[model samples]
Target: MTGKKRKRIKIGDVYAIPLPNGKYAFGRIFKDAGIGIYKYIGVSIDDIPRVEEYQFIVGVYEYVLKSGVWTFVKYRPFKSDDEAFPPPSCIVDNISGEFSIYHKGEIRSATKLECEGLEVAAVWADNHIIDRIMGVDKWHKDDEK
Candidate 1:
């Protein structure tokens, strides 16, 4: 028999393992045995009991140049899906100049702002959404500083 090497698995990496029932089990590699085997924790995406529905108002902000003055305007508030998560504040894509909102690991909304000479911005979700994306509670503490 020819011996073939398998790719190494890392911790926190999601992977699929074949089961005896001819089905695949999706899980995350939690621990490594240093050998070829790895300890995996099963993940059931459809088994999540219930996710609380959260509603928030989002305001899109943009800078409009009228005459020779630049003004910032806060657009009307709009409702966002619970899955819409903002990108990290530090991750700014300079190439596309596009901002995206993600839902279920996919882009739900994308907007290309005109940033040639004007400051184009949008109010992402409320404080809760910002905190969830940033993985921090700084939004609530912003008032203290």
Candidate 2:
């Protein structure tokens, strides 16, 4: 028998692995050293790899070991569409106790801004959503370091 070299994982290769209740899951490979850890996310439980890497793209679904069910989740888009970043001139206006974010229009929310270019209304809409996933007061605490 001719022995072949093992294949290497890439950014978009999908894998399937066994799961509980005779089920399986699917996950894609992704590497991002910035996140510091690698794991499957959106795929099935059966597809997760028992290895180490920077970050792996996971499917937003999982296999139920006991019930033998597949549950799909509403996952955010894996790829970012925008390649350009806003200039540093963006600002959030604070007047007295009221805070308004002005981009193209007035923003009306109270969450920490990820960037300052998103309009007030857009930022306001994002605040609650961002807060639920990552706390409300999220910001760089150690920028000076």
Candidate 3:
């Protein structure tokens, strides 16, 4: 696969990710999953800030960040089957194994490096949650049936 240098994304960076329905979700980086074979791209839920409420629904994405003043970076999906036990497709020395985020970026990147796991650890400790909108369902669950 073609690889590029991975960019370290910060909060406020805009991004776009594909939805299962063929649509796409866009938002800013609420959290970052330090460098690794893969990375997490956390986006804030429309009206929510906490990560607990809606995180399980959208889950973390495996992706690559694009270059330039673009929030909507193109990315590939980490096959749904890989969701259960996500191992880094390709990890750099300065990163973690269980990276988490809302979107995917950095599938194959050269800019990969190690990151401070403290920030991410704190977010997880808070049980970060994103609130759901009145009309939009964060995700589909079998219980909905």
Winner by lDDT:
3
lDDT of the candidates, in the order given: 0.28, 0.30, 0.31
The TM-score of predicted model 1 comes to 0.18
Q: Model 1 segments beyond 4 Å from truth?
A: 1-8, 31-145
For all candidates, the clash counts are 0, 12, 22
TM-score of each: 0.18, 0.23, 0.24
- Best-performing candidate as measured by TM-score: 3
Q: Write the per-residue lDDT of candidate 1 for residues 4-88, one digit (tens) a residue.
A: 2223333322223333343323322222111111122123322211222222222211111111121111111214533233222
Model 2 lDDT per residue over 39-124, tens place:
33324443344543323121122112112232221122235323111112224455644444332223444445554443222222
Please provide, for model 3 over 36-64, each residue's C-alpha lDDT reduced to its tens digit, 9 standing for 90 to 100. 11123324222212221222222233243
What lDDT score goes with residue 1 in model 1?
Answer: 9
Task: State the lDDT at 84 in candidate 1.
Answer: 31
**Residue pairs in clash, model 1:** none
